[model samples]
Target: MKDQHEPKTQSEWQTNLEDIGAKEGFYEALGDQHTALFVERGDTLIVTFENLDHVYERGADRMPWGYDFVTSRGWSMLGLMAHDWTWYRDSEVHDFFDRLRDEGFFERFSNVIFYGASMGAYAAAVFSSAAPGATVICISPQATLDREVASWETRYKKAWRRNYHDRYGYAPDLVADASAVHMFYDPRAPLDAMHVALFRGANIRKYRCRFMGHRIASLWLQLGILKPVIEGCVANTMTQAEFYTLLRRRRENGRFQKEMLQMLQKLDRPKMLARYCTAVLARRRGPNFRKALRAAEEQIARTNK
Candidate 1:
C-alpha cells in the first residue's frame, strides 16, 4: 500500500502485523516473543518469514501479503514474523519451533512451503529443518550473519554482533532434510552470492539471478513472476526451466529494463543498451525506456563520431 520500505520503529511494525492478522482472521501465537500468526484455511500450509518492514507496508486488506503470489492457490498461511534479523535466536523463537515439532503441527498439512528473503530467508532455511519434506524458497538469504562463521562477509556488519553459534544458527546446516531448497541470489551482490555458496547439499539448487542484487524478490515482484514460481513450488512443478520461463516477463517489465539499461550504460555497452531500450519500447511506452533510449543513442552518436 505505502512505498514498501522497512519500517522505522518496532511499535508501528508490530501494530501493523497485529492489525492485519486480526482483520484476516489469522490467530496469533507468541507475538511478543517471535510474532507468529497462522490462518488455517486449507490443507496446504505456506509458512513465510515476514520482515517487519514488509508487513507494515502491506496491510490486511491485501491478505497474506508476501505470499500473495502463491497464497491465492488456496493454501493456508503460517506467518513467522521477526522484529529485525533476530536470526530467530531468541529462546521463545526456538521454543516455538520445538513446540510445533513436538505437537506435530507441520505434519498435519498436506504440503508446506517455507519462504523468505534476506534475514527472513535465513530464518526460512533454518526453521524449515523442522519439517522434513517441506519446500523452501530463499531469496538473497544469508547463510549466517554471525561474524565468526561469516567473517569473510563484511556486509551486515551490524548483524555480526549477534551470536550465530546457537541452535538453528547455521542456515545451511538447518535444511539437511528438506524436500527441496531453491536459493536465488544475485552474483553482483558479493555478500549474497557468498551466502548462497554456503548452502550445500544434494537437496539444494541455487539459481543465479545476476545483477538483481540483494533485493531480488522485490525486483521479481515487479516482474510478476514471484507468485507463479512459488506456486509451482507448492504444486511440485517449478523446474529451473519453468522458473526461467516465468522470469522472461522481465523483458517487458519496466524495472528489469531500467536495471539492464543502467548496467549497460555503466559498462559502456551503448549498442547493447540501445538494443534493450528499443526492444522494451516496442512493447510498452514508458518514460524510463524513452530516457534510456535517448541516453543510449547519444552515447552511440558520440562513439561513432
Candidate 2:
C-alpha cells in the first residue's frame, strides 16, 4: 500500500483537503465520476467546478481552482471535480445538488458565487440553479451539448453521448433565475460565440474577450487580471467599464500578442501585422515579434515593388 502522505487516489485527495486548513469541511464522492470538496470559511461561498485530473495536476499544493485565493479572503468553497469530461451529467451529481438545495445549504451563505471555465464553466452555470439567487461567473461556457439544442457545437464530441436534455441539462435555462451571470468568451471563436448567444437574458452580462480564445481564464491569469476580476465579480462590484479596463492589460501579454501576430500572419494581413508588430516592438523586445515584423516588412516591400 502507498503511504498516506502520497495523494494518489481520490480518498487521499480528500485526506489532503483537511490539511489545507478547512475550518469545517467534508469530501464526498458523488459517484465514481464526481467528487465534492467543501471548505467552510465565512458567510460568502464560492462554488467551483473543475476536472479531477486538473485539480490533482494543478500544482504542488493540488488544491481546487481559486481555493487559496478564495480562502485567504475568508470565503467558503465547494469544489466539484469531475473524473473526466462528463460535463457533470450524472444522476449522483444531480442528487447531490438536490440534497444541498433541500437542506438549504446555500441559504446559510450571505452570498454565493458559482465559478468555472470551459467544461467546468458549463457545470457551474447549470448547477447554480440549485442556489437560485447565486451569482455565476463562467468563462467560455457552452449552453448545452444537446444535439437538438446546440447542434453547432462540434467540440466535446465525447460528451455528446451523455444526456444533456435531462436535469441540470441546459445551462442557460438553469441559470435564468440567477441574480447575475457573468460570461466571458472570445467572440472570435465561432462556436463559443454561438454558445454565448444561447445564454441571452437580462441578468446575463456578456464580456467579449476578442482574441483570448476559449481558455480565457488561463489567459486572464497570465495577464495578472484574473484575481481582481474574480474578486470584483464575487463582491458584486464588477462593471462593464471596470472589466474592460482590466482586460486592457492583455495588450501587454506576450501570449496574447504572440497569438495575435500568428493570426495576422495566417490571414495574410501584412499591413495589420506591420502596425501590430510596430506597436508591440515599441514597448517590448520580442524575438518572435521582431522576426514577424521583418517578414511583414518584406512582404509589404515586395507588394509595393
Candidate 3:
C-alpha cells in the first residue's frame, strides 16, 4: 500500500502552501513543505527542477512528463520549483538537499529518475550526485551559464548573474557519480547544442535530436513519445537506437511534417519534392503537405519552360 501525507482539509493544505512560497529569492514549496510527503508513496521517485512559468503555462495540476507514468503503480515526485530561473543556488535550496541527504531520502527509493529540460535539466544533472546511482534524463541542459566558463551563452544573460561556482555549480562535475546521464538536444540549436557539448563525461549518454529546436521536451510530448522515453530512462533501459525508433512516431506529427516540408522545399529539388509530397499525401492528408505538393508542381512547370 502507498502512503500519503494527507492534510485534514483543502484550505489547510492551501494555508500550508502559503507560508511556503512568500519569500523573495525563496521558492515554492522549498524549505517549508513536508519532505516526508514529497517521497512517501512509492519506491521510485522523480525529481524535477521546474520554473514557475511552467507551472503557470500548464497550471500546477498538470504533471511533468514522467510523473503520470509511475503514479498508478506508486511512485513519488519532488518538484524543486523555482520562482524564476534562479539556477537553484540559494542557500535554502542547498539546505533542502542537505536535509534530504541527512535523512537518507534517496535510500528510501529502490529506483529514482531525475528529470528536467533546459535550466531545470541543468539542476537535475547537478543534483543527481546526491542520489549516487540514480538516472538523470535532461533535455537541452546547460553545462553552466556561468560567464567564466560559458561566455558564449549570450541567451539567458540574466542567469549569468547567478554564481555557478557555488556548491552544486558545475553540472558535469556534479553528475559524475550518477548511475547514468541521458541528455537530449537538437544539434541545430547552436546554443543548446553547445551547452550539451560542454556536459561531457564517460557517464553521459548523448541523444542527438536534430532539427527539433531547443524545446526538445515539447517536441517529444507533441509526438507522444515523452512518457515512454522517460519510463525507459527510469528503468535504465532506454538506448539511442530505442529512442530513435520511438522518434519514428514523429512521421505523423503535424509540426514535424510541416518542418520537413519546409526543409525539402528549401533544397530546391522540385522533382524530388513532387515525388516526396505525392508519397506523403497518399499516406496521410496534411494540409501543409498538400499545399507544398501543389507548389512543387508549379515550380516543376516553371522549370520545364
Most lDDT-accurate candidate: 2
Candidate 1, 26-55: lDDT as tens digits: 545454546776766678988888755575
Q: Give the candidate number with the greatest TM-score.
A: 2
Tell me the tens digit of each residue's lDDT in model 3 across 81-163: 66566778676777778777788978988988888888789889888877888899998889998888888889887677887
By lDDT, is 1 or 2 better?
2
Which is better, 2 or 3, measured by lDDT? 2
lDDT of 2 by residue, 1-305 (tens): 64556677656667787655345688777888777889998999999999544555574445677887988999999988787889999999999999999999999999999998888899999999999999999999999999988787888899998998887988889998999999999999999999999887899999999888887887887889999999999989999999999989989889999889988999999999999999999998888889998999999999999
Worst 10 residues of 1 by lDDT: 60-69
Inter-residue clash pairs, candidate 3: none
Q: Give, for candidate 2, the lowest lDDT window spanning 10 residues.
A: 52-61
Measured by TM-score, how close is model 2 to the native structure? 0.93
Query: Could you tell me every candidate's TM-score relative to the true structure?
Result: 0.83, 0.93, 0.82
Question: How does candidate 1 fare on TM-score?
Answer: 0.83
Off by over 4 Å in 2: 1-11, 18-23, 56-60
